[model samples]
Target chain A: MKNIVIGQYIPGKGLFYRMDPRTKIISVITLMIAIFLLGSIPQLLVAFSVCAVMMWVGNIPVKRVIRGMKPLIILLLFTFFFQIFFNKEGKLLLDEVMHVTVVSVLGIVLWTIIWRLLARIGKFKTVLLLAYIMGIFVLFRFLPFGYSFTTFRFAIYEKGIEMSIFVIIRLVIIISLSTVLTLTTKPTDLTQGLESLMRPLKIIGIRSEDFALIISISLRYIPTILDEAFKIMAAQASRGADFAEGKLKDKVKQVISLLVPMFIIAFKRSEDLADAMESRNFVPGKPRTRIHELRFGWTDIGVGVFTLAALALTIVLKVIG
Target chain B: MSYIEVKDLSFSYTGKRMILKDISLSIEKGEWVAILGHNGSGKSTLAKAMVGLLEPNQGTIAYDGVVLTNDTAYDIRKKVGIVFQNPDNQFVGVTVRDDIAFGMENLMVPQKQMLEMIDFYSEKVGMKDFLDKEPSTLSGGQKQRVAIAGILAMQTQVIIFDEATSMLDPYARRDLIEYIQKLNQEGITVIMITHDINEAMYANRLVILKDGTIFSDGDKWSLFKQPEIFENSHLELPFSLKLAAALDDSLPEEKAVKDFLWQSISNT
Candidate 1:
């Protein structure tokens, strides 16, 4: 449970860390738009280099940044595969027919069994498994199993390969850019930034501070609620209620056993919280002062202007193409 | 006028039975009072009533001569603060620093003053280094300290601790009791609501509640002299007193017994 990193913020003293959270949020959004607007390889390289430099200058650990991307591996691969298979423009690179015969089938089965065993030993590293799978297919082509049971065509084109790489890089850049925003800004500051951004909604009679408070309170209670949920689960388990080992209908019943108590606890907690808030002199919709005031310095203005410029340039690039 | 005055206080919640009934109490400035009771004894309700968190069905609570009504409750809250039982439920800020600043912010204190108060009170609570720490990462005790820090930053004249240490471990409870004692020593009025006779021992005055009424109100010595009061409230006598009673059947070596009594009670 402690390993959840969706809202993780690492304290640091760097350019991005020092920038105003509002500025960082606006800049990250603009940069992401620019990244998606990138069309040619040169434009992609420029955007990639800028993100690399930002990461380097921000002093963010590269290992942690890569770890943050682990959850995206499947989505990235899906995008890569979809582009490669669906795209058919540009010159043909390779086209071949492969046979599925007795010996070839034997080799394929043997390769799969060996690969699975080795993958387990290797901790199932994605790149290693992929390479091993590709190597076996290439090796089987040389086995010369001419008594064919079936055959399938395998082809690759220039545009397909180029499109896959471009799209994958775009996705990576967008992810890393947003990661930089969340990693540098503390959760409090993030919500405060959101409040500042939503200030315009005041014209419509919406109080931004209330919205920010709701978000922050939700973030604060998520872990505490989860902790209670786990305790409730353990208590139910002690009473012969098996949540993990149960039939479909039984699982639903067990889940309700957990949910009912949780809902009660949550409602009671809210009541207590309201009482506490009132005791602390908190009045809703009342003006309040903050200890950590967000000040827009010259550097913030500079960053804001730079991001705007980048967004404009991307717009121009898109128009030209 | 007394520092805090609650007169003829009777309260119930939404057509429910009376939780507190016709309770009148007055606390002097700089006094430490313990309102002791068992689980449904209405001591907690009395605490909330005193702070204007709950309006009485038929009575008036006044602080520094101003009676608390709907219009003046907000103003009175500025002078009195409460540290509730559940630490997680009371925490309004994401971090310790912000939590400490919460009360001051509500009063629209200047940013500069709020910063200074956060620093001073957080240090007073010994949570200076945990200013950036989130509430979830902190222990139940640490969260309570942050809560106290928030109240202290408000600079309230009277602090009502509503069983503040009930949920904490023994060590944490002891630490918090010492801190509260120090606060009382510094001229702040303290009203601690608890069922622990041992905790009530630290207060200069003890008010026992039973069945939604004041059973006894006096010093600990008087309360101890009346053994029935303890039994009626379901509060346990300190082990030393029970031991001394078993040994000789009469109070002996008055000073020695008192010293030993406090020592044993604190140890637990």
Candidate 2:
């Protein structure tokens, strides 16, 4: 449960922590743009180095940032595989044609059964399964003797692997930079900074202040609602709701049971919150003052300049290369 | 004039069934009053009506002679604030300091003054050091204390507590009760709506509700003298009060019952 650290603010006192929130927000946006705009390996290396230095200077733990990315591991892997298998623009590293025979089919089946039996005794079952899949691919490439219909060709290209690496690096840098922003800036400041940044949109009647309020409220209540939902889930589980051990349909039914109660609780909470807000004299659209005033300092200016320069360098490198 | 006056107040949620029926009560300045009742007795409904959260179907509530209507609700709100039950639901800010500042911010308090008030009220509630702490990390008692501090920061003259300690543990409830008592001592009018007779005993006056009507209203000692009324209303008596009533012929003074019980227990 504690692993759900995405979008959560970690209190800190690093340089980025003290830098103005507007500066931090702008810098993060700029860095993200630069990362996506870079075309060559050298540009990516530069951007990655900048991210690494930012993580170190911001006092952000690399393990914590990686843990924040844990939920996206599957998606990252999918992107990597998609790029590797589909992008065919470079020199072929390996190409082979093979025939399949009955004996090889039997051998492969026996090997899978043995591996499954061995996997039962393994501590890292997932790692073992991945290894088993890789072994199957190697077996097909080398031995490749099943039936004639099962025989085919396999190829690996340099461009595919390079494209996959680039995509993965882009994802990592974007996720890491955003995580760094959240870790250093408190949620209140983040929202306030966003509100200030979007204040210009108020001329078009966008109500950025209200939007910021909504974001802040949502961020504040996500963990709280999750906690409530977990409690309800536990309560239902105690009453024979088999959320863990159930068929797909049964699990979905259990989910609806949890969701209905959660929605009711959320509605009641919003009504109560409205009352509380009114009692506290909160009238929407009225000018309100904040206790914490945001002020830009020298560090903010320096960071702002550095981010802009980095963005320009990436664009120039993209064009020149 | 009474500090708060509610006359012939009747309210219904759907206009079909009455939640509060022709309830009339008045509270004097600096009075510590507890509205006591069992569940579904409409004590909370009355508290909401008094605070202008729910408009009565018939009758009027006035604060310091100013009538509470649609136009005056905001002004009355500035003078009266409520700390509701379910501390997590009432919290609007991510952090303690922000929560305390929320009310003041809505009132359009200047930043400097808001900071000073947040500091003062948070310290008064003993939550000064926890200003930067997230609300999710705090205990039920601590959250309620922060809620009270938020209300106090508004500088409201009257503070209505709608079962504020019902969800708290014993120790937290005691801590909250002590704070309420201290606030009353400091001349902040307190109207606590609770079903706990033990908690009701801390108040100067008791208003017991039953079936959407006022069943009984009197000073605490006088209310305790008539244990049958408590039994009729389905409210449990505190241990000392129950013992005092059982040994009625011997125990003359209601206030001495607690000390007597302590002495007897020590001797035994």
Q: TM-score of each model's B chain?
A: 0.92, 0.92
lDDT of 2 by residue, A204-245 (tens): 999987998888788778878999888998898799888778
TM-score of each: 0.87, 0.86
lDDT of model 1 at position B184: 93
Q: Model 2: residues >4 Å from true position, as ranges?
A: A1-10, A66-84, A90-93, A98-134, A150-152, A156-162, A203-205, A222-230, A233-243, A319-321, B222-268
TM-score of 1: 0.87
Question: Alpha carbon lDDT of residue B187, candidate 1?
Answer: 91
Model 2: CAPRI class:
medium
For residues A1-321, write the lDDT of model 1, one tens digit per residue: 543444768877888877888899888888887888879877998888888987997798877778778889888888887877678889888787776778887887888888788778767578766766586667556565657787776677899999999988898888888888888898879999989999999999999999998998888888889989999998878887787786899998888888999999999999999999988888999889887899888878888887888889989999999
